[model samples]
Structure formats: C-alpha cells, structure tokens
Target chain A: MAFEDKLSMILTIGILTSSALMLIGIAAILIQGGAAGHSIKSLIAANTTVNTRTLTLQDAFSGLSGITAIYLGIMVLASLPVLTVAALLTRYIGRKDNLFIAISATVLFDMLVAIFLIPYLLH
Target chain B: MLLLLLVAAGVLAGFIGAITGLGGGVVVVPFLALYLGVPIAYATGTSLISTIATSTGSARSYIKERIANMHIGVSLEIGTTLGAITGSLIAAEVYALHLQYIIYILFGLVLFGSSYFSIRKLKMKNFVPGKADWSTKLFRLNGSFIDEATKKKINYHGRRWLLGLAIMFIAGMLSGLLGIGSGVLKVLAMDSAMTLPIKVTTTTSDFMIGVTAATSSGIYWERGFLQPLLIAPVVLGVLVGARLGSKYLVKLNSRVVRYLFIVVLIVLGSQMLLRGLGVF
Candidate 1:
C-alpha cells in the first residue's frame, strides 16, 4: 500500500473519534488548566508578601500531584490520533522505518534519566 | 481546591495547546506559578517535557501527510541536536545562576519574535513562487507540498539543508535554554525562508522538535530534572492532544489560528519574564 492510501483509512477512524468527543475533552481540559494556573498565582503572591514563607520541598511535587488525573483524562484524547494517524501512515508507507521505534527508545532513555535525576534533584 | 484546579489546568492546557501546538505550556505555566503555587523553574521544565510529547504525538499526522520529509528532518537535526547540547550546558552553568533574568528575557524575546514571524506569515501571500536563495538553490532545498485547499501542487525554490540546519540550531538553543519547543522558528524557516506552505512547515517543524527535546531530556535526566511520575501523564496528555489537534488542523482556519497562536505566545512570554525578574 502506498503511504497516502494507508493514512486515509486510519484517519477515518481518528476523524470519527475527534468529531464525537472533542468539545467535551476541551471543556474538561480548560477547567483543569485554569485551576493549576490559579493555584500557582496565589502561592506566588503569598510567598512574596512579607517574605513570610519560602517554598517547601512539597511545593515542587505539587505540579505533578495532578499529573495522573490529568494524564488519564487526556490519554483517551491522545490515543485517538496516534491510533488513527499512525495506523493510517503505516498502511500508506508500505514499508515501516525504525523512526518511531527510535523515538520510543529515546523516550525510554528520557524516562530512565528522569527516574534517576528527579530523586537526586529533590534531595 | 487549588490542587483540583491545577489538575484542571493541566487538562485544559493539554486540550487547547495540542490544537495550538502549545501543549498546555502557555496556559499551564503561568497558571502553575501565579495561581497553582508551582515554582517557575519547575513549571518551565515541565512545560518543556510536555511540549516534546505534544510534538511527538502530532508527528503521526505529518508522517501520514508525508510533508514531514523525514530525510530533511533527520539531516537538519544534526544541527538542532548539537545546539541543544550546547544550550543546555550554557543554561546550567551560566544562566541558571547569576544571570537568571537574562535567561528569562532572552527566552521571552525568542517567543515574541517567533510569534511575530508566525503572524507575519498569516499576512503573506498564499504560495506565490519566490526565487529560492542561492544557498537553497544549491542544495535543491526547494520542494513542494500538496496544498489541500487549492488542491494544487505548490512548488517553491528555497534554501533547504543549510537553512533548516541553521534554523534548527537556533531553535534547539532556545528549546534547551527556555523550554519552548521552538517549532515556531523551525516553521518560520520553512514557511518564510524556505517558502514551503504553512502546513508542511508546521508539521515538519513538529516532527523535528521531538529529537531535539530527546537530546535535552537525556541530559535533564542524567542531571536529575526529569520525574517519570510527573512526565508520564503529561506526555500522555500531550500525545493525545497534539494528535487530535494536528488531524483537525486540516479543517480549521489556519490564518485565525496563527493570530491566536501569536497572542498566546506574547502573553506567555511577558508573564514568564515578569515572574522571572520578580516584577510580577
């Protein structure tokens, strides 16, 4: 299969999924982003005034506290495109290169580094 | 309440950002620092990681389109990858310590500049053939992408290998230093300088940023900045959001989106600068 043809079929599924749920997903994300933005703003204000309280160790981890909830919510949205486009492209290209495979490897490399470093940085 | 809100911000940023190629940074970063209580450095690093995820996710579409031009993307990346290593080192040694404000200002400026370039492209003529620069002509940098709108082949003569390589170098530096994906610069190089249509430029630029970020993420990991738990979900969000956004982009009014993108960049840039300088 030519790359273009393969892509068309895969995108059909993607377009369907996106059309079905884009708005709902968008709304959910908006609310989440607004909250994170607001919390940090208040913290900055509180910290600056009177120089009363410096940021604590827990302060750093606060950003990721919401990661799981936000991640899961967004993952459904993310999966749609990857499945649609990637599948489509695979069909179109006929020959698959190791490009994405390399990317997956690099991502793993990134994860491993993070795994080691986050602990050291926090301490 | 605040934590709940931050979670919401992450999700929303993911939602709108993928469409805009922002990956929730413009919205999430400011909100994290000003509203959610996250520190600026933490916010910046997190935003950078998410931006890479968004780009990686979106690469699927570009690959599908074949506009990503993997040959060009991978080749020019040599420069971008090198630039990333250098910039990260500089940021850690010099900017991270004594001249923090300088770093903020520089990154903010890069943002505004790239935004302006994007906006300028919106006003530029649609795919009029321009004479390729001598450099582009030499390397056969000129190629065309299918303009789905006009349903016509848009051909151009422009600087290819060197121009992209140079632009990627600058883009990589900013990516490492300030935490932006620098797709804006990469896109501008192709759109304005190389004369590719916006879709090709945008998609290819997104295609390229992943590798650039990968380089930095490695160092950031070894030096201990990456947090798997923190990055995992965000990457998940970014991938999904960017993929959807890229797919739907074919339907949206890109001119309108371009302006919106510029405005967001300006807003984010100013916010970061002010906060970093303690003027916020």
Candidate 2:
C-alpha cells in the first residue's frame, strides 16, 4: 500500500477509536450520574477542579469510569499526529532517505519534548 | 443540558468553519468565551483540541487524493512546532498573570484580519510559479497534483523556503496563543510567499494543522485547560459536523455562505474586542 493510504488508514482508525471511547465515557457519565466520585454537574462545570493536572495516567487507567475513559480518549486523539510522524520516520528510515529522516526525527522530537519533557519540567 | 448546548455550539462552529474555509477554531473560541462564559484559557484549549479532530479528518482525504505535499508539510512543521512551543509558554504566562484580556484582543484581531484575507483571496488569481531558488532544491519543495476541476496534472514548486518558514512560525505562534489552526496564515505563507498551487497549499495546510495544534494542545493539557467534559462533546460534535459540511459544500452556494460567514466573523470579532475592553 502507498504511504498516503497507510496514513489515511491510521487516521481513520485513530479517530474512530477515540470517538468511541469518548462516547462510551459520556454514556458512563450519564448512566452513573458521576465519575471518580464527582457529580456530572461538577464535572461539566467550567471551573471544575478536575483536569489533566489533577489526574494521572495511572488514575485514568485504574478503571473504565467516565472521566477515565474520556481522559484516555483525549490522550489517543492527541497522540494521533505523533503516531503519524513516527510512521513517516520509520518509512524514511527504511528507504534510507536521510534528509526526510532528519526532518521527521526533528518533528517527532519536538512533539515528545512538548508532551512529556516540558510538562515534567514545569511541574 | 450544558453538554447538549456545548455539542450544538460545536456543531455550528464546525459546520460554519468547513463551508467558509475559516476553520472551526475561529468559531469555537469566540462562541465559548463570549457566549458560554467559559474562561478564555479553557475556551482556547477546547478549540485547540477540536482543531486536531477537524484537521485529521480533512487531511486524511487530502492525503489519499494526493493533493497534499507531504514533503513541504513535514519540512515546514519544524518551524511550526517550535513556534507552538514558544506560543504555548507565552499563553501559560499570560494566563498565570491574569491577563486573559490580551488573548481576547489578539483573537479578535486575528478574526478581523483573517476575514479580510478571506474576501481578498476570493478575487486573487492563480499563482504563477517563479524560478526555483536554492532552498527549493535543497528541501525538494515541489510536487504535482491532478486538478479535479480541470482534470489536468498541474506541476508546482515552492520558492523562498526561508520566508515560508518564517511565516509558518508566526502562524504556529498565533495558533498556540489563540487556540486556532491559523489556516489563513499558513495559506498566506504558501500561496503568497512560496507561490505554490492553491490546491497544494490548502491541502498541505490542512495536513500540517493537526501537528501544529497537537503541539500546543499538549501544553494546554498539562496546564489543566483541557477539561474532559468540555472537550469530549466539542470534539465529537465538530468531527461529525465538519464531515457533513464538507459533503454538502458542493451543493451550497458557497459564495453566499462565505459572505454570510464574513459578516458573522466581523460581529464575533467586534464582540470579543469589546468584551476584552470591558465594554460588557
């Protein structure tokens, strides 16, 4: 398959998976009337104290609660572009296209630093 | 009830954005901040996350159609990602200092500026590619795409990579600062500066925005701006609405729609500006 086709497939699968997880989260919230001990009303409030900074990945994966599912869904969505760039890097490396490999590597490194390193440093 | 309202707002923003080509962030940020009374930081953060949805959705098709120049998009991303990092940090500082009014004013200005360009672009003629410079050869900034309207293979090459890169950096900064895709500026860099074919420019812009937005959204996420309840509904609604709008775009009298949306942009921009000025 062509590179574009592979990319298209990855995006399709990634979006579908994320959307499904989010919907499942909404459903769980509605059915349970809350998530992680917070009421739905509180969770939906603009000034709600629950957010990424207060929640850990381990907490999100501890159970399939509404908030946790939504958190995981968002994590998946945010990682889609990184996954695409990684795929591109792998392809370029296979072809020994050093220039594109360097470019892709730089972009991937930037994303990783922003997602992981900066947050770690700031906190 | 709030969730439903948020979803409706997302749908409207995404639908308007797709049909007018102004992008969903333009609509999402203003409506959330001004109407829904969400904090500016949270509003922009939500818009940024939803932008990833629309970008990825559209870019998938563009890539398959082979109109998007991956070579150009990937190379320019170096500048955009770096700019996004700087912009996100600036936004963090601004929010921390309780100067959200700055973001409101800047977003309003961007809306006004992009509206003007949208109208001007309607009257612009096709680009005539100039001589390839050194940056073009070094970056391999050239590609060909089959035009659907003309059914002809149109070859195009980009020149002045440094200028394009510089503009892309600014575009990325605006994107992070305002939680927008800044597609208008990206188009400006590629269409006006790099002199690429419009098809190539637009598609590649779509392809690049996801990464640019992802860069900033990551930082926003860490800052606790990405509330799950707010983002989930908006992202889902935008993804669905953008898909519907793109399907109906050919049937709609887009010129009429564009003019209507331009009017909406002016109104929203002015409202945001006034709000920032404490007129409300």
lDDT of 2 by residue, A6-118 (tens): 99999989999999999999999999999887788888887777777776667667776988888888888888989888988998999999999999999999989988899
Once fitted onto the true fold, the runs of candidate 1 whose alpha carbons sit more than 4 angstroms away are A1-123, B1-7, B12-17, B20-28, B94-99, B133-144
Question: Which lDDT value does model 2 have at B261?
Answer: 57
Writing each residue's lDDT as its tens digit, candidate 1 over B142-245 gives 55677655676766555555766788788778777655667777777666666666666666676666556655654453443333233434444454566567
Which digits, one per residue and each the tens of the lDDT, describe model 1 over residues A29-119? 3445522223423422312221101322244236643322333332333243334333433433454645544433333343334333532
* CAPRI classification of candidate 1: incorrect
For model 2 the local lDDT of residue A87 reads 86
lDDT of 1 at A63: 66
lDDT of each: 0.55, 0.82
> For candidate 1, what is the TM-score?
0.66
The root-mean-square deviation over C-alpha atoms between each candidate and the true structure, in angstroms, is: 8.3, 2.3
Per-residue alpha-carbon lDDT of candidate 2 for residues B1-280, written as tens digits (9 for 90 to 100): 7788789878877676555445578888887888788888888888888888877777777788787888899999998999889899999899999999999888778778867876875575555797899988899999887765556778889999999999999998998888888776887788778988766776687778889989987788878778789899998998887777655543544246547656867888888888889896
In candidate 1, position A100 carries an lDDT of 43
Q: What is the TM-score of chain A alone in each candidate?
A: 0.28, 0.92
